[model samples]
Target: MPYLGLIVLVVMIAALIDIVSSDDALVRGLPRWAWLLLVIVLPLVGSVVWFVAGRPVAGFSGRVGRDRPGQASAMGFPEYDHPGRFVPQDPEADAAFLKQVRERAEAQRRQGEIERRRRVERERGQ
Candidate 1:
């Protein structure tokens, strides 16, 4: 009986913490206040229902489960799953991208100088 009481107390506390800490968007089936009320009114049953239905499913990695097959993990944006996400995870790839940007800027500077020189020559001729 004492163990049962302890279990119920733990479950009630866990439910309250979960309700308070969970994002409104992630909670399902009912509003947070309603869930809180339910948990308070019927500790064991409400806590069970909240865990089974209201709370979002998370895996061992702490990533929310995908809603469908082939969907991205909820921890990141869907764009992160795309091939062109542009996350430079590798140092070599990051360096290469920086180099390309530098090269493009240098080219643009040279083109700007040439255009300025041509404009000056035209003015001189006039």
Candidate 2:
């Protein structure tokens, strides 16, 4: 009888860990929190329910699942990929983007200098 209790405890622990580790996007049926509460409240039944309903089905790799081809790599969204490690697909487009950024910065710098000169002139006149 005591061993049966230990088995239930083990099952419940496994269920809890599975619930916690599963991605929110992959979780099916009830929300993760509700499933957690159910499992805590009714150990054996809740664990069974969780395995049957809440757990993500097989082959689910998260928001960036293997089935999704729009995403290039396993590093997550392309824009949010680690900086300095992002390899641009089109070098020509990347160069043009950099050129636009430099031009905009130069224009802003010129405007700032003109404003500074005007401010100095006003102070001198006063």
Candidate 3:
């Protein structure tokens, strides 16, 4: 019974760390909720799934099951070189890109308007 408790404790700790530290957007398209469910509802399966499908370290090489290179390895936590890498992309980039597209569209609209005016003038012969 004591051994079983220890095992459960270890799994809970691993699951919490994995969920908290994971970048759901960066790696697989799965959500954190799914991971939480897996860990909470099913311990053994959840731990395996977490280890297999979790994010990969930026510069780590070889099999993921292996120990981390330099950083502390705790229940296969992926060591991100920069966690900010997973941060949602800058809204500024989206804004600037949209701005460029809008500008191009506006220029095209103005050119079309000028052409229409020229055509109308020619038709009126004035």
Best by lDDT: 2
TM-score of each: 0.47, 0.49, 0.45
Model 2: how far residue 103 lies from native, Å: 25
Q: What is the C-alpha lDDT of each candidate?
A: 0.75, 0.76, 0.62
lDDT of 2 by residue, 1-126 (tens): 769889889999999999998866668898899999999999999999999988988653323343344554424335433212444567577657766776898999999999999999999999
Q: Write the per-residue lDDT of candidate 3 for residues 1-126, one digit (tens) a residue.
A: 769878876987787687877655444436787777777888777767776775444554332222344542222223323333232255466456556776898999999999999999999996
Give the TM-score comparing model 1 with the true structure, all chains together. Answer: 0.47
Q: Tens digit of lDDT per residue, candidate 1, span 25-118?
A: 5578999999999999999999999999998555334334445557763223343343223344564765666667768989999999999999
TM-score of model 3 vs. true structure: 0.45
Off by over 4 Å in 2: 60-63, 66-126
* Total clashing pairs in model 1: 0
lDDT of 3: 0.62
In candidate 2, residue 75 scores what lDDT?
Answer: 40
Better candidate by TM-score, 2 or 3:
2
